[model samples]
Target: MEQLNNTFVAVQAASRQLALLNSKQINNILVAVADAIMEQSLFLLAENEKDLTRMDKADPKFDRLMLTEERLKGIATDMRNVAELPSPLGKVLKENIRPNGIRLKKISVPFGVIGIIYEARPNVSFDVFSLCLKSGNACVLKGGSDADFSNRAIISVIHSVLKKFDTDPHIVELLPADRQATSELLHAVGYVDLIIPRGSSNLINFVRQNASIPVIETGAGICHTYFDEYGDTTKGAAIINNAKTRRVSVCNALDCLIIDEKRLNDLPLLCEKLKKNNVIIYADAKAYRALQSSYPAELLHPATTESFGTEFLSYAMAVKTIKSMDAALEHIQTYGSKHSECIITEDKSRAELFTKVVDAACVYTNVSTAFTDGAQFGLGAEIGISTQKLHARGPMGLEEITSYKWIIEGDGQIRK
Candidate 1:
């Protein structure tokens, strides 16, 4: 407990120094870190392979855990992009002169120290660090045991870059990959300003229920896409195929397909590409009958009540048939995880309605839910896709990680 407390205290202390660094200095550090990642890509991959060998290749998280040279390059590119973006700190959100000779200004500031507890995805270590550094916030990472080797390697590279710049490496600390460390970080109330958990629903729930600090829920994407009666079969097929198979382990990957009852005839054609990819389909009665002749018997199964709301994180999806647009909306409301939802329709009114009424962070019209990403949305890179609607609602980037403070200046005005 004492060692964990010391780590937290050091991180909190280093945050003040990190916040004082000018934007140029921070950006230079970020660029250096990105370059360092690329330089040590081979080492990072070897360490990642060590972790990968312990897990089954069939596990969905295996894809997320495994890192290739291409992926490392992408991570580096994201870091460079973050460096190129404008800093969110010190921005004046509001300013006013009071009647009592006092001036007030609300300016953006860092959250002091952010504690992130995530599972399996080692890339998150690099991502959260880049975002927190760019936004002038210190971060304490609690990575799961599944990717401990990878996270350690990534953190070492980051520390080397920080040392090269004469910056305190404790500004970004990685806690031990153990349950005790997680407990310590969660209870570091005075030290950590916020806790963001990015992983499965169970993990997010555990953090939310257990953490003493403020929590921001992310990950666990039970996303859905509605194929309206007026949806183009070709476009719907292409969109569903890309969203499901592009990268099944991602949070934005579609899990449920809502089909307008009138569009049942188009279901088979819409799912043709999915069949080619060998995606398993869990269909309700109506959809099952519709797909009976077209879809492969081995890949098709009757969806249980539990299927609709599941985040497969694999080559699998649930199909629900709705009688009307209202039914589709109701279905989505019942099962959607509020992460991302999409509608493919030729009718503009229906599209507009879906975009407006669907309770999701990201609502799409004729596009894949896979576009719900921080970098893809032009925010450089995201810390996570927040499902909660309080401080943050969607992709958490630099600005999302920051909080604001009211600075008041008085000219010898005393209150009665």
Candidate 2:
């Protein structure tokens, strides 16, 4: 508790100063941070490998945890891109002239200190810092224990860049990777402005349930892709393969497949593509019976009730056969995590209806669900893919990280 208090105190003391940084100053620091990251790639990779070697290669998080030269370059590119973007602060969203001779302006501003509790992905340390800095907010990062070494190295690089600019490094502080400190951080309502959890469903739910600070939940992705009766089997197969197998460990990877009952015979095309990549299918009884004759027994298994909503962060997906588009929609509403959902259909009206009716952060038509990302959306980087719709939804970019302040100018008027 004392440790967390000290960290929060440092951030609270520095938050105002951070918010005062002009766009040019913030951009310059971010550019320097990007250069520093690229320059120190050897050191960063060495530190990352240390953490990677301790974990099993078969683990899904390994892909997210390991940072290669290409990924490092990509990270550097993201930082530069963030620097080039327009500043989020000081944008006047609304201006009003009141009858009492008062001018009211609602301007965007930082959220002070944002506390983020995430797991495994060390790149988030840099991504969050860049977004927070670009938006003029201080951040207190609490990374999972697995990436301790990598995160330490990354933060060291970031702080060094901050020091070079004569800015207080406390603006991007990292909390101790322990449960006790995390507990204190969760309840530090006065110090932390908002909390965002960006990892497993269990972690997100834990923070949502326990935190005294306001939270924007980034729920786990039990994403789904439905193939309508009129959809092209070949194109649907390609979309499903890319969405499901492109990067299975990530949040946007497809977890469930919904096929029209009329197109049940075309299942082999999709199953063949999945089997080519060695993906195992956990199918509902209807889907299982339909697929049993063609797909190998090892590749097909009966899905239990528990499989419907599960986020299998692996090369595995749950399959279901639906009678109609409505049935598919109902099944998704019941089981989806509201993260990302897609529809593969040739009929324009059906695709439009699916997009309109499906309540998700990202709804797709004739496309893969894997494109649900901040960087992919050209927002540079993201805090996380928010599932809830209060403050921010979808990929939380710079604007999403900001809040508005109403500035009222009056000579001698008061609220009557």
Candidate 3:
């Protein structure tokens, strides 16, 4: 508790200093961070290897935790891109002049001290720092213990750049990887303005249930994709395969697959493709029976009730059948995580209906759900894809990290 309290004090003080920095200075720091990452690639890789050696290779989070030199370059590229993005602070969202000659403007501003708790992915340390700094917010990071060594190395590189710029390194602090300190972060309400959790369901839920500070949910992706009666089987199969296997250890990966009953014949073809990828399918009664003869018995299993809503962040996926678009929408409402949902259909009206009825941050038509990313959406880098609809939703970039303030000017105007 004492450590957390001191960390919060430093963060709050740094937020004030951060607010005073010019956009050019921030961009320069970000560029320097990118360069530092490239220069320290070997050091970072050595640190990352320590964490990787400790983790099981078969674990779902292993892929996310392991950072290769190529991945480091990608992270560096993203940081440079973030530095080039427009500054998120002090933008006038709206302006007005009243009949009494008073001027008013709604301007974008930072949320002060931002707390981010995440797991597995060491690159997220860089992403969160880039977005928070660009938006003029100080961050307190609580990374998973699994990637402690990697995160420390990455944060050291960032801190070096901050020191080079004569900025307070506390502006972006990584908290101790202890569970007790994490719990303390959840209760730092007055100090941390907002908290964003980006990891598995258990982690997100723990932060949501225990935090006294405001939280923006960013993980638990029980995402889905439906194949309509009018959908092209080839396209649908391809989309589903890419969405599931492109990167299985991500929050945006497809978890559940809904098929139109009219197109049940297409199941065999889909099963064949999934089999090639070594994907395990947990199917409902009907789907189980249909897939038994088509897919390998080893990869096919009957799904329990718990399987439907579960976010299997691995090669396993759930399968179900629905009669119509309405049924698909209803099933999604019940099991979906509101992260990313998709429909593969040639019918325009059906696609429109699916997009309209589904309540998710990102809804796609005839496309893979794997594209649900901040960079893919042309937003540079992101903190996370927010599942909640409060302050921010979807891919959280610099703009999403910022709040707004109203600026008013008057000539001695009084209200009665």
| TM-score, one value per model | 0.99, 0.97, 0.97
Return the top candidate by TM-score: 1
lDDT, model 1: 0.94
lDDT of each: 0.94, 0.92, 0.91
Candidate 3 lDDT score at position 90: 87
lDDT of 3: 0.91
Each prediction's number of clashing residue pairs? 0, 0, 0
Question: How many collisions between residues are there in candidate 1?
Answer: 0
Top-lDDT structure, candidate number: 1
What lDDT tens digits, residue by residue, belong to model 2 across residues 164-199? 899999998888889987899899979999999999
How do all the candidates rank in terms of lDDT, highest first?
A: 1, 2, 3
Residue-wise C-alpha lDDT for candidate 3, range 1-416, written one tens digit per residue: 88679989999999999988998999999999999998999999999999999999999999999999899899889988999999989899999999998999999999999999999899999999999999999999999999999999988999989998999999999988889879988999789999999998889999999999999999688899998999998898899999999999998899999998888888878667778889999998888877888899999999999889988889999999998888999999999989999999999999999898899999999999999999899899899999998978999999998999999999999986
After superposing candidate 2 on the true structure, give the runs of residues whose Cα lies further than 4 Å from its correct spot. 414-416
Lowest-lDDT window of 10 residues in candidate 1?
Answer: 328-337
Residue 211, candidate 1: how far off, in angstroms?
0.8
lDDT of 1 at 227: 94
